[model samples]
Target: MGLEVVPNTREVLIDLYTKTLKEIQVVPEDEGYKKAVESFTSHRPKLIEKKLGCGQVEELIEEAQDELTLIGKMIVIEEKKWLVDEDED
Candidate 1:
């Protein structure tokens, strides 16, 4: 099946990646998960810019969207854990 083409894929992906990077700050910097996320999230926009300069990015856009969703969920989970830890103290 073919993926639907977003009218503004470049702008949308940049926004998503930017938001993901910002949201990921909730995770502790020392943690591997945060490091991994920061590593990729920081590079994705540059990659997208390079790719968009040459050709299509429908696949990349979809991937960015998926990552954004995951980031949102992870942030929520981390916040919940923090709340639990606070309550226990």
Candidate 2:
């Protein structure tokens, strides 16, 4: 089956990528996760600007959403870590 075209794929992707980049700052810069996320999140927008094919753009959008989910999980884990540290004090 063909992918259904979203009316605002570019806007959606930009918003997602932007939020992901912002949220990822909570992660330590030296961590591989942060570096990997920064690399790909920065690259996806260029792909959009280049006007990649619909299938490729859709794939990027899905990947962006997945990354955002991962960022959320990372933030939660960090918060929990902080709470545990405080409790041990």
Candidate 3:
């Protein structure tokens, strides 16, 4: 897995999610972002728990990458929805 961008200097995952939500126009609602966060939280540990009791940052990156894939798709859909709405006005 590749190294993911550092999620800001905050010590909490929720903080990271909150900050990320502010930076984007689409999927800013906690439900959407929270779903992504939940996806990462579940899958990340599954991969991590695979290794005795220790996991590497790379695993976290993998988990992040997976979550990003969903976010990107959702963002595209949201943007398209916004564009269509504007056209109808």
Candidate 4:
């Protein structure tokens, strides 16, 4: 029998992604933003796990990357808006 390569578990991936997300310093001041961030961070790993279980590893990774990109853009936009508002004060 040949050796098999096992992929990391969903929890492991979630932990890794969470660590990466922690590097961002944006503190969401709005309830909507807080909920959005919470949902995005929490739901993605579940989605990825589902997709991976269905033998859709490629699609799962691509979607996760895209979602992270969107989240990063959101954080940047929020940060910029906050900075501009502060400048006006």
Best prediction by lDDT: 2
Clashing pairs in 4: none
Error of 1 at 29 (Å): 0.7
Model 4 lowest lDDT segment of ten: 1-10
Give the whole-model CA lDDT for all candidates, comma-separated. Answer: 0.78, 0.86, 0.53, 0.59
Residue-level lDDT for 17 in candidate 1: 77
- Ranked by TM-score, the better of candidates 2 and 4 is 2
In order of appearance, the predictions have TM-scores of: 0.73, 0.80, 0.42, 0.50
Candidate 2, residue 11: lDDT: 98
lDDT of 3 by residue, 1-89 (tens): 55555553223333444444443445655765766665545454454335523344544444445555666787788789899999999
> Which residues of candidate 3, in runs, are more than 4 Å off?
1-26, 33-60
TM-score of 1: 0.73
Which parts of model 1 are misplaced by more than 4 Å?
A: 52-56, 87-89
Runs of candidate 4 with Cα error greater than 4 angstroms are: 1-16, 19-37, 40-55
Model 4 C-alpha lDDT per residue in residues 1-89, reported as the tens digit of each score = 43233376465557645843563335454656556656666666777745545445444444455656766787788788989999999
